[model samples]
Target: MDIKNKVALVTGGGTGIGRATSIALASRGAIVAVNYSRSKSEAEETVQWIRSEGGRAVAVQANVSLDREVRGMVATVVEQLGTVDLLVNNASITQHILLDDLEGATEEIWDELYGVNVKGMFFCARAVAPFMKSNKQGSIVNVGSIAGLTGAGSSLPYAVSKAAVHGLTKSLARALAPEISVSSVAPGAVATRWWEGREEQMNHLSPNLLLKRIAQPEDIAKMICAMLEQESMTGQILTVDSGQTL
Candidate 1:
């Protein structure tokens, strides 16, 4: 699957891995729709950057947790850039509750995390399926976390949500076979805004990895583009954690 001239939609395409991926896709000649829930300025900045680099892009707004909004967003992308050929389900959110603090993992916390991290991915995938099927080919890469595999993260619900995302990726792969490919990239401790206030912790954890450093957004972004461009792989979860899980 060569990415050239494909219409790519990247949810949360304002910061971190999402931003890197939008840029990467555009650099490869894909027409990009940069989706954001609230980070309007950042999304616009990303769009401007891509345009400045001689790439085509647009900043779109949608809260992916809402199925209606996801559908509307896909429609808007089609109206503006044609049917979506690639999707990067990169939008996600998390809370900082300690894993052992079951009380802190309240119903609202569970709902909020799952809404954005798990259901959001599904909604986006569902919204775009028809277009991909119409085009006869498509690719999707869900952004998962090593925490999904390890059951450890900022919060228990967040880890659980990511695990669900991995499951969704496989199911979508099986459900949308022959015409579309679905996969996941599970990254560990990426150097993104998610670690803003936890800089000291990130610094301390870096040397513990086999690669001696935590992953940068581009590292994960590169893997995502690779997953999108490959034709033979599906229902796979590729880890770009600098060997952290090892």
Candidate 2:
């Protein structure tokens, strides 16, 4: 589908992949709604950048874990930017607990991780489905992780949560096919804020990676743009892992 003048909503668009995605979509002539849970300033900055580039955009605030908030966010986007033609589920949280620290992977951590990663993506997709169906055309891209495919990440719960996202991508694609295409991008060790203090770990692991380096946020963003351009691709998880899975 042509993204020009389409309205796109990106959750957690304040930083990392989401921010890059927002910019990419805007550059493609889409009216972007940049969503953020706490990074309001960052979201605003993204909006400003898009505007500076002569694109249309707005900063939206919402927590994807809450269905009510998700609903409200969709409503605001529709009201302000028009019904969403593109939805990018990018908001997620993870803890840096070691796999050996079974004690550290408590119920609270599980809930927080799942709430934002699994349930959050579902909630946002559910909220936007109606709008997309109404238009009879749309695209949904869920930001997952290579860890989901390999069952490895900063924490076990984080990996499990992203795995659930991959499952949801398939299920949603089947459920919303021929109208709203659903797909996912699973990136490996992106150089986002999530890896701040873990630089040494990533450095140590880099040599083993086939690409011998980590992925940048723009690498994942470009793949998302490519998926959105395709009309026949759905229920597919494109892994932009720089060959880490190899």
Best by TM-score: 1
**Candidate 2: pairs in clash:** none
> Residue 61 deviation, candidate 2, in Å?
0.6
Q: Can you give the lDDT of residue 114 in candidate 1?
A: 94
Per-residue CA lDDT of model 1 for 89-208, tens digit only, reads: 999999999999999999998999999999999999999999999999999999999999999999999999999999999999999999999999999999999998899999999989
For candidate 1, the per-residue lDDT at 63 reads 98
Model 1 gets an lDDT of 0.96
**Model 1 TM:** 0.99
Q: What ranges in model 1 sit over 4 Å off?
A: none
* RMSD list, candidates in order: 0.5, 0.9
Candidate with top lDDT is 1
lDDT for 13 in candidate 2 is 95
* Deviation in Å, model 2, residue 189 alpha carbon: 1.0
Predicted candidate 2 versus true structure: per-residue lDDT over 131-214, tens digit per residue: 999999999999999889998888999998999999999999999988999999999988889878878987887888888888
